[model samples]
Target: MVTFLLGFTLSVLQPVTGLRGFDTPNDAGGNITLTWESPDSGKVMVEIFRSQSPLEGYQKVESVLSSRREFVDTSAIDGIKYYYYVVSIGEDGKTDRSEILGPVSSAPQWFNTKRWNVLIILILLIIIFFIFIRLAKKGTKTYIRKIPGLEALDDAVGRSTEMGKPILYVPGLWGLTNVTVLASLSILRRVAKKTADYGARILIPNAEPLVMTATQEVVKEAYLEAGRPDLYNERDIFFVTADQFGYAAGCDGIIVRERPGAIFLLGVFAAESLILAETGNSIGAIQIAGTTSTLQLPFFVASCDYTLIGEEMLAAASYLSKEPVMLGSLKGEDFAKIIVSLLIIVGTVLATLGFTRIIELLSTG
Candidate 1:
């Protein structure tokens, strides 16, 4: 009777209470969330334990402050039943355990509801793209801002013709797989057409053999389009060395010897950007340079007469082509960017005014 009374008193003295375990929501499988009422007793540490059975094999999983009411067990295996409990340790090191809570398991959700905002935004953008595509097919013209670098293409070509010197076109150092190289190819077609129109010579030296072959076709097509296919010389579009610095040195030699009246640098470049640009600058060539490399842009801007910055180079093809499909897609994307920017501004204002539900609505997790 005395032992029984002492055990009952200790049970009643336990400070930890109301422990519960459940599958974590909006997550992949293999996780369980444990929650408990915060210990009301003075200064304590809470330890979390897990077990396969309610009565045995319990293992300590985590420890947190008594003020904490929740913990996530990331080690929980999917589809495996587990038991959990909490033990609160007082300042004096006395521990009080809560009743075992169990039979909880983890399973993955097919769709995380927390990412609803991502779904909505994606759907909205798709709808906008389709709308613009339809409008473009109906012959609606989309207005785009002028990029001065592209605007100077004609002047560069005219200058080369008047000076009676060949126009040097460098299709950059990267392979054809790069987007900037592809963009450069598009601009090349326009330059080739102009050169063909004026009966002027054009020289295209490439760093990649594949790019050399592709440039031949692009320039050939441009000349044909300009009704001057007979003047298309495959010899003019040739491959230079693939070695980076060697290619730069080869281009520098061409600039110094041939002294191209106008130099068009439009593609992905690295350290060689300055080398090529500076060489062309020293020759007094009418230089037009563009690239997506931020590190290389300052060099181009400083050395070249015309520099296409960032998206300006990306948008140059569409701007020059005036193809309805390309223009419409470009316009639609610009609108989507504007809408996202406005949403951010509005969300900021609402949050500052203590109305943060707008932010909550857009949260992805």
Candidate 2:
């Protein structure tokens, strides 16, 4: 009886069996996986523990149902050894500990092969862009569709000249950092040149100091290019308040007082877009607007005489410049869009036919 009692006590105090840990494969590192066999005696919960050293400082990392046999430790440090173990707890609070496993270290990989498709696409685009640019430099003709809003620029400027009224340009509420503002500046240069040629006054009121400075420079350059430096007025290009509504109010005041013949509202805008466009409409000003803001497009389209939507705002720079490089880049972008559209159509067809190879290839991990 004494021998049997001793053996039973030993069994009760024994640790859980068959615990194992290994480093996870095909990863950027900092991970280890632990697994264990289920306790045979009864249903129990398993607790996982980890430590930097095998013999000391083991802290519980996770608790899992008895049916689960695996845990992934994502907190492992790269280049540092880690130790782990498991404990099984019975429903009656009896606990058994597993032998610790040690010295697993995470490592980094130089490249992620999963992104190979992305790399191929990037290379192809670069090749296409360069090829088109080269062809353009060799004097290949690139056809661009006519944009009515852009085509109307000269007529707008001519009308302003005929009316003897200043042309008002608002470069939106954003600063120079925005792509839309940059495009606006490019359009501004073209407008300034037209106004200079026709000897008409052009007023550029800015909500940003940097934009004001850029406008002054661009307008002055345009005047000099047109051989009408005398017509360039520094005061006409001035900074207004940066406050959105305040800037709109100030621009409205200018519209009311100056009654510009042509008003160009281009760049990033918010609620102030409707305010400006409606005011321009009320004053009988010939308003031309363009913006990447989808919400503001309807307002411009409703209130302005002409509005350039979405890509037209981006294309304005290339269209107005007519430089070989810009034209080539634009054409390349169109080509890329066509390719992407074709791929989408093909992928859809294949997916409908129960072939998902293309879809899988395009999918990102």
Candidate 3:
């Protein structure tokens, strides 16, 4: 009877079994997965613990129902060895522990299998880009729609030239790192070329010293390319105060004093968008504005003669230059958008018809 009672007590104490752990797969890797077999006797809550060494420093990581049988320790440090075990608590307040298992370390994978869809789409874009570029290089005709803001550039420069007044160009209040500033620089090159050809003086005021320096180089290069290097003046492309409203005020002063015939406001703008645009408007200067700032777009639209909205400003470099590589890349991205849109629509229809495999594939990827 004693031996039988000892056997029964041991069975009751053993509430969990077969505890094991391994590093998670297909991940950047700072995670370890643990699994255990719950006892068939009844429900129990399992608490997971981890340690750097097998016999010490064990810290409780998580508590889960025995039925779950699995847990992922996301806090596990990559490249470090770890030991883990589980303690199961029964309804009768009895507790039992599973054997420790580990010395396993997490490692990052080179490629994630889950992102296969992204890889395929990336490959597709590259193929499309190359194909379009090849066609363009072979002199095949490709159509790009008219952008009125860009088209009016030459007329604005000519008006300044005919009126015998200087043209003012604001390359945005942002630093050279801003993408809108880069786009503005591309448009600046075009304007510089036009001004050089027309012999109309161009004045560029910058809020960033780096942008001022870059503008000088860009304008000088444009002048050189136009074979009018003599017309390039470094002094005209200068830095104003870094303060937002102060820069706007300085630009306004230039408009009031220099009385430029035309103003080109292209790049990122904030509250100062209206301040500058309205100032130019008061001076009766023909203004063309473009920015990615949605809040300030209305101000530019209301004050400027032409406003290049959002992506139109981004696409201006390719549109104005017509370089085969740039145009090809632009068109390839457009094709990618169309493809993604079509897939979304098709997936929606399939899901509605109870064919969920397509939706599942997309969702998983």
Candidate 4:
């Protein structure tokens, strides 16, 4: 009895860490959702209970819920005044309880206007997105605040230029044909142009022949942009043997021999990430690395001065492009991220208080 009350109170409070709300859809007779954040420790278990009479008698009701936010309580009968509550049960019968969400109406919702409403919402979101795009075009910065990475590129390149050594651009192991590889090549255009302007040479040792080819085009363009096209040399952008370590060894050779001032490890990478980073560290080069590979992230974090983790790699080209599809996508991601975050906060509160039904109700609503 004591365990039930404590669970009930905490479930009502729904105290948690890292939980995010899943998208809410009303089609399921029992709408279910998930929370992104999980407990740092402890196995989280959920249970439901019911009462025809509030305090006197309550019966245990097992509810099927996802490992995430909320679940639909479809063990429900229409026109019946049913009471529902939950418990966050832990080991040894220890549990926290939630407040009842009840006497709920189980009749289908939006047997009303779903079809009509869907089109309206799509149009609204579309309009809102374009409006922001227009504002952006007029030189009106959106209300969102950011500290962009590309803005720092000049600093990275300038530092290298001052050091009187070559700059190393490694596009890692992804094939040249990948979109991200192409994006990385685009960034190299800007970086190369900056290097050329400073009269500092860049060395691009790529793992793929196709990426090597595209990179050559971009670097050539950069030199052209800086009006130093004659200064561009094919030897500066060369293909390294594609074996991971073989490529790493070639990059290492350039770092050691050419003594480059800056080393950029972009696109994709793996175990060689550490080999390259530690080498650059030894050379005292300003190393900035970006890659989408999760496994190698730790090495870049430790060795590189600036590490672009995860999707930041993809966002790099868009940011550099400053075009509508690119910038628009960037802004869209931010808005979606915000919506995702708020839902988490609410779901945690409802689940803690034994009101996970609120997650379902509010999410679907």
What would the per-residue lDDT of candidate 3 be over residues 154-270, giving only the tens digit for each residue? 999999899999999998889988999999999999999999999889999999999999999999999999999998889999988999999999999999999999999999899
Clash totals for all candidate models: 0, 0, 0, 23
Ranking by TM-score: 3, 2, 1, 4
Name the 10 consecutive residues with the lowest summed lDDT in model 2.
8-17
**Between 1 and 2, whose lDDT is larger?**
1
TM-scores of the models, in the order given: 0.78, 0.87, 0.90, 0.61
Error of 1 at 261 (Å): 2.3
* All candidates in order of lDDT, best leading: 1, 3, 2, 4
Q: What is the lDDT of residue 130 in candidate 2?
A: 92
The numbered model that scores best in TM-score is 3
Tens digits of per-residue lDDT, candidate 2, 137-241, equal: 999998999999999999999998899899999998898889999999999999999999999999988999999999999999999999999998999999989
Please list the C-alpha lDDT of all candidates, in the order they appear.
Answer: 0.90, 0.89, 0.90, 0.71
How many backbone clashes can be found in candidate 3? Answer: 0
- Tens-digit lDDT string for candidate 1 (1-365): 99998865554434666778889999989999988776464546888888999889999999898788889999999999999888888777877778888899999998889898888899999999889978988998677888899999999999999999999999899998999999999999999999999999999888999999999999999999999999999998998899999999999999999999999999999999999999999999999999999999999999999999988888988899888888888888998999999999999999999997987997886
